[model samples]
Target chain A: MMAKSQTHSDGDLGDLLRVRDGFVLADVDTRSTPGYGQTKSDAQDDLAAGAEEFDELQERLYAQSRENPDSPAVLLVLQAMDTAGKGGIVRHVIGATDPQGIHLKAFKKPTPEELEHDFLWRIEREVPRAGYIGVFDRSHYEDVLIGRVRSLATPDEIERRYDAINDFERRITDAGVHLVKVMLHISKDEQRERLAERLERPDKHWKFNPGDIDERQLWDDYMGAYQVVLDRTSTPHAPWHVVPADRKWYARLAVQALLLDVLERIDPQWPVASFDVEAEKERLAAS
Target chain B: MMAKSQTHSDGDLGDLLRVRDGFVLADVDTRSTPGYGQTKSDAQDDLAAGAEEFDELQERLYAQSRENPDSPAVLLVLQAMDTAGKGGIVRHVIGATDPQGIHLKAFKKPTPEELEHDFLWRIEREVPRAGYIGVFDRSHYEDVLIGRVRSLATPDEIERRYDAINDFERRITDAGVHLVKVMLHISKDEQRERLAERLERPDKHWKFNPGDIDERQLWDDYMGAYQVVLDRTSTPHAPWHVVPADRKWYARLAVQALLLDVLERIDPQWPVASFDVEAEKERLAAS
Candidate 1:
């Protein structure tokens, strides 16, 4: 069942993929590409075509923000399990655009200094400026996901983070940021194959972590934690999208489509030149 | 007038442009493109051609760092007065690379909380990770530039920051970072014209702060402050390159060339695969 009425040709992916109230992660098919009907080659073609449009739209957003400092920005938060293709999405989807227009931060293990501040302190510092597309690869959800399954934080502290994250999302959205939170979903079998391949490949050996396998063993617990996250933190302002990532091509295309949808809705335009164009051109030429 | 022996055809721009002992800000022509024998069109062609090479080199650097976490990173510190084209350099030079590899920080007026820490505390938080190209739009030099000119810090305190900066830079470089400090030099008349253009254009109105004119009034003092900065902090390990920025195209091209030189020197290669690649490929195919 869809959360919202279908409006677009591809149907509203946000409505279809968004985790609604009383959502269950287990019920969603990790192998299915909901509302999208395209072959892998077709998806590749569509993604390639969309790159130029995405680039132009990003530039427009950057230009508009530069001219009007109060303009809004977009933030795409990507969270996924190990081997779920988050890197591919970042490289293929967001990577096609101008680096000048993007603000990306990959949160690793918290530094000693970071742990001293409230969990949100470091996250707040990396929020994109006006007219930019800020991407967070594995965001604040880590505090809840790993913290919940690993019992890193006390139960009471873990409960507080959910509330803190919700409030933080609301505050950022109110301050003119369109937040797009994505969870790239892949099956256990798929992850196993991916990890196995990493072990077999010398080039991918560096990417393979023994810790990832440890977390994989606690998969069900992590899933339960994610269920709670979907229930608690998926607010209207910054709802989470459960993107089936078994097909990397489909997932990258879908993410790009989602970004395009948001940018279309925002409809950022290049600011009209405020100076006399002809006069300025003449002056520049003379100079 | 060479500070170091020439090693390449480009004649080691790092050596030529570097602020050596007894460096005079006034002696360096703001309009000159020293050691670069190219017209504006020729520079543009070179920049376009080098973009792909720069992107590839950056990716290799990123890959190398990802594989070997201890690998060094490059930090490019850009300092310039209002309308001196720091934004242009960022857009043209660094913008051509992967956003994922870039760590860009535009230091605004520090927050009340930031001021509570040692000034370098905020700077340290924003330092680029291993394999990243960290670009600071305005950096630690601000403390000396504004602090000395406006007397924000006591004479003794201002003197202390110089030593502190040198020590801090040495520590970072020792910890595997190649620091490249750049100051975009523009003449008083050039700045006045640029300021006039900003005022003339309504789109640029947001960029033109009335306070810039106030700062312009004290140009001589700022220049004196910059002279001291060049003299006191231009260490061999973390030397400052003063780029003549009157020509925006030339400045952008020169900055890119400078970055290319640093990257060339670093010569990062893709890490050798530790695992059996053929086995991984077969496993991935089978899976």
Candidate 2:
């Protein structure tokens, strides 16, 4: 199912995966840093307004999907580090979705039963049907991210899974499932701050895992793993959108934009009127 | 916290429960049904329009939550029998929501560790924060539903849980969490039809579980179990809506109406401008 599709020129993958020593090594300091290279002074204002406008468009698209039940489905996969705001993104970015049509599956550490099947079996069962949308909090990408970071998979095995993911995602898209994958990028400082907050707040305590600190220690290793994962798996069928998540608004805006763009591309229709009105009308006239 | 808030004067508990069971037990004949009565004609239309409307409103409510960072969170829980459309409703209803501010958690049979805690503990941790929405495909209600259905909990034990659930939900609401519960009701024949279709279709085979049919055989018992569950647990704070799932549209619409009503009540805000230039300028000129 692999498409010898053109490279990332049409998408944001190349720039998104730019990294060194794995930590998304970039000069992403928003406050003191100058604006995104080519954008204008009012880019922020424009971006915000554009996001809201896209939101309006999205509302309509969603309504259209419901009104016309035959519309193609939307599937979103979120892959991120522990404190990288996967939960935050789900809470904030897609917060406005209709609960009836949105399917969310969160893949945590696999259970013994889950381990019995091939890695993607659980996810395969959870894919949204046509005209629906599915969001994976942590997706099949785990095979690469955690596996590579932990060195659980051999180098050859990691490479093979990359090809496998490419094939799997291509089949889904070929079957008309529009896919969007996002990697929320947060700096070490931000991670530390959020981790502390999770620990400090009583209600947030449930979210804190001491294991996350251990993962944080391997930040560089994970970054190296993500760089290769991005390079190998970012395909035309399902490209990655790596948003700067330290600043929440920008992250939300980027995700919304990517969704709007893809959904509009595969704009689906509600089922056609089941009964033929003209035929019924003709029969009535003849009677 | 229990307000005998008797807002539901639409009908008597017994009558409504009877109506509920009547609707569930109503044969394939929608033409002349007891609970449906004359409500059938408009029921089809309402189902169609209602499902779409519910999805639209849910998306908007979720969006409002995201934009207004301080808005109270919304929790949507779906508890129902097999093939009752828990997965279907989640997909069709909330699919359009922005992924950032919405959290979707599906609870399966308990893991060993999860079984260790009180049923509510894991679910409590999964609730979305302020300015977010959370949807549970199965939830703490399992403590009552499955516990009662499987006869795992005695009648007295289940009775104590009613108050505990009320208190737990009340605490969530008091903490600024809005709760919405939907019970999707599908007739036995429709379920049989659906099961047959799943068996016939290759892609749908994964969804077909023989266990679902086993549960269906105990349909009447499940109905009585649900009635008790609904009666004991439906409080003024988090009243339960028994959605008619025979027509998918009606199921979606009723859910939408409830969601829109709740969100309108919440009325989340747009962020206050950091710099209100007009007001600042006016003050400066006056000075």
Candidate 3:
């Protein structure tokens, strides 16, 4: 219904953005609008509209869990190069709902304890409980992505991790958790502009780390790792959406729309009153 | 600068709403927009503007923490009667900032594990980590309020909790944690209308517990418990703000204003660049 006939055609955003078996990371034009044909302002309006929907749906999800603890929950996994708008999605998109229902975990460098265990051990502990929307800023995929690019893990170890991740995600999805995986696709030139801007502004200095330049130098390796990931781990239960993130507004809009699509499908209903209404009303009136 | 000249006059909102030793719960006019002199629509406009300021100030605080891990963090302790709009504050007020920098805990009735430890033990663990905004929807105050009213704890135990709370708060403040304690004061009539509405709306029934009526019956005791709480815990380190809750907008605006005032006073600065700006820009441009 939101599909406009200006510069874009119609299809579900989930279908439009999902990467199947042969998606080459280099083939995606980072600046292309893809499924969205609207102007920037229109997308902004849609974002606001979608946010209201997210709040209502998320609240229902939260409410349903209160009635039934076994109710379905959602997990949004965000993977991206540095400055690929991961935090922006957290702020402007998921930030629209109640924080009570949103469980957010930002995985930084693994701690000494985390390094000692299987990589997914820390991740397993932080999975969103029922009736909550869980968001992972950087996830277990880092073990495969950075783990591959930096030789942090051996080739055999990296090879087994893809299957481990698929198995883990399958387990989560089978347990009634809806998983939405996103890889923010930004072009090398686009990253240059972003990094350059960060350097140009003193206010954003805290966000810029020298290691970012080192990562930039290994962009192709990261892209290759991402491609390998999509080929190996894009399952029916937990499909990955490769969102073009050169435009911050578009990335936020696409993710919001996709999430709305999933929430709509889940269709969490308002919980039924566990107590008798008539008796309660009379008692309330007396009180 | 956000102070409206009309309904709300010129002193800081922190000073305007802070309760001192002689404060009485029964004397507060729940429906009055005490410090907010503006209409509801005007207050809504201020809320939006303040959200933007909150975003900026909060980012500065977050950024400062990245540079110095030992930076000061904020904790907003919300203690309210049911239907006093604590959830609304979490969704609307604290919801305005980045989730990465915000830590929210909604403490329900403690489970057996929580009861096994001291009341403040669970609370001690979740005190927002360094450089974050921690929000407790209904916090440790529950220990005293419900504990005192229901005789859940011994009378002697109840007497010791006041000093326990003060000492705990003092330790927190001394360790560079700024505590903003709020008690949402609603009248008996207001509670009836709110509870009535919950019972009336099918969608709101999940929020209504028959137990709420039981608690409503002890309104006088809860009020007495609150009076003692304000009398004891309202210290210079963590002063309590008694916000009139019948007017939701004013309570939200006052709390947001109070938080902003603290952030303004803290004056989190832009971190100085650790790397050479020109060198990074040149490297970025070349990449």
Candidate 4:
């Protein structure tokens, strides 16, 4: 009887693994989704090629705003588990951007002052102005991830937050803020390799916390928590793109594609000059 | 008398150029100073090499902290003219540092809210916690530069700010924050070239504001302002390193060197546990 129960558990695990892998493949190919890149490839080399194209697209999007003073603002939220490569994606995809046009805010464990306010208050303060891009590294998603994992909030309260975030994102989207959300997902085995690498590499050691292993032990809990996070918050206006983060470059490229798609959708145009430059030139010539 | 006056003016211009060139060189070299690295041939080369080395050093520093848990924090302050390479340096050098351990804050033209408080208030709020690095792009030196150049303060008032800034640096330094200040200097001709390049480059056209040229016309005044900024704020605790701006790579390398130098000074050691591993292992094995 015990052996039969063990077999049943193993079968359930295998099914989950298959489903996760399927999502990984689907994410790379689904270009029809709004704010997603159309070009899809599974090979590492193809992903890199796509990355190069995506980078050029991003530069052009930034250029669009520079040329046109009235482009709507863009806010990109990146939330993921540890070793999900948030900084790597930021540097690879967003590093070349004009610093004046991009703002990066990394939210750590909330400070005492931040805790005193609502979950979104600190994030609200860092929103990019119109015509600029704001990138959040581990943003307000923490409210759900940490709060739910620890049972810090009641079930009803958690449900309310899911709605609150949906409403919040929609309001920001309506108010000329283009919101793109990406959740970087990595397999448990991949996460183990990454954590081990951080432990072995002296330079990466500072980022390693033994506490992370404790969280790793709670892997099933986190997966369950993230499942809830994705299902509840993935709305039409600010749907979450679960990027496969095992390939760091691919994740970055995918993010860039989403950004470019949003900016291109805006179709920014240069502001009109109040006077004619040719007439002024002719006046000066006549004088 | 006219000949003597021309000679004096020429000497003044030469002194100004010498000081300006010194700043440009120091800014480039300082980036590499915090780590072991070679000086580059030109600004572009310096930035590339400096960036690579700075990234490596940041990783090393973090690794050291994780291993030892006692590494002193490194604080980098970037001060430069409007188009100086502050943003680029920031993107390249600190770009790879773990976002959790790195704090980046841009001090823009003071808002009304900022003006209500002391000049250092905003900065105080952004200082990194223990075991973290803080990078400030345009820091408190504006108190001396803008204050003196615009004559917004009386001579005594400017002098007081200098003293206050010195005190501020001393306090932070004494409290374990290693402060490295860099000033990026560009020639008037280089400024013209950069401004024109922005206008001519389709992608950079938006970065070009005609008002920037208006500020360029006050080149002499701004130089005087920087000279005062340097003289008044260059305390032994936080001496300013001026880097040449004509070569961006060289400036990046210089900055990297300054960072490595400070990190090497505070080589953090990982604390070892005093427990008997053999006994613990045996107990675990038996269990």
- Return the top candidate by lDDT: 3
TM-score of every candidate: 0.77, 0.50, 0.97, 0.74
The 10-residue segment with the lowest total lDDT in model 1 chain B:
B1-10
Q: Count the backbone clashes (under 3 Å) in each candidate.
A: 1, 49, 2, 47
- Candidate 4 deviant stretches above 4 angstroms: A1-70, A95-101, A196-206, A247-249, A267-287, B1-47, B63-70, B92-102, B131-133, B199-203, B267-287
Instruction: Write candidate 3's Cα lDDT for B37-114 as tens digits.
Output: 678998898889889899888899888888887888999999998899998998889998898899999898999999
Chain A TM-score of candidate 1 vs. true chain A: 0.95
Candidate lDDT (C-alpha), each: 0.82, 0.63, 0.88, 0.64
Which pairs clash inside model 3?
B7-B37, B8-B37
lDDT of 2 by residue, A22-128 (tens): 34334455222112332333335544455454444444455455445445678888887787777656655555555544677888888889888878898899888
For the candidates in turn, chain A alone yields TM-scores of 0.95, 0.77, 0.96, 0.76
TM-score of chain B of each: 0.95, 0.75, 0.95, 0.76
Model 4 chain A worst lDDT run, 10 consecutive residues: A13-22
Better of 1 and 3 by lDDT: 3
Number of the predicted model whose DockQ against the real structure is largest: 3
Candidate 2: residue B64 Cα off by (Å): 25
Across A47-141, the per-residue lDDT of candidate 1 in tens digits comes to: 78777778878877887887688898999999989999988878778878867688888999899999999888999999998999999999889
Q: Which regions in candidate 2 have their CA more than 4 angstroms from the true location?
A: A1-71, A269-271, A278-287, B1-287
lDDT of 1 by residue, B1-287 (tens): 11111322257676778899889999989999876766778677777877777888888888889768899899999999888999888877787777778888889888999888887999998888899999998998899999899998799999999999999999999988889899999998898789778756655554555567778778899999999999999998899999999998778877877888888889897787655656655544444
Candidate 3 deviant stretches above 4 angstroms? A1-9, B1-7
TM-score of predicted model 1? 0.77
Better of 2 and 3 by DockQ: 3
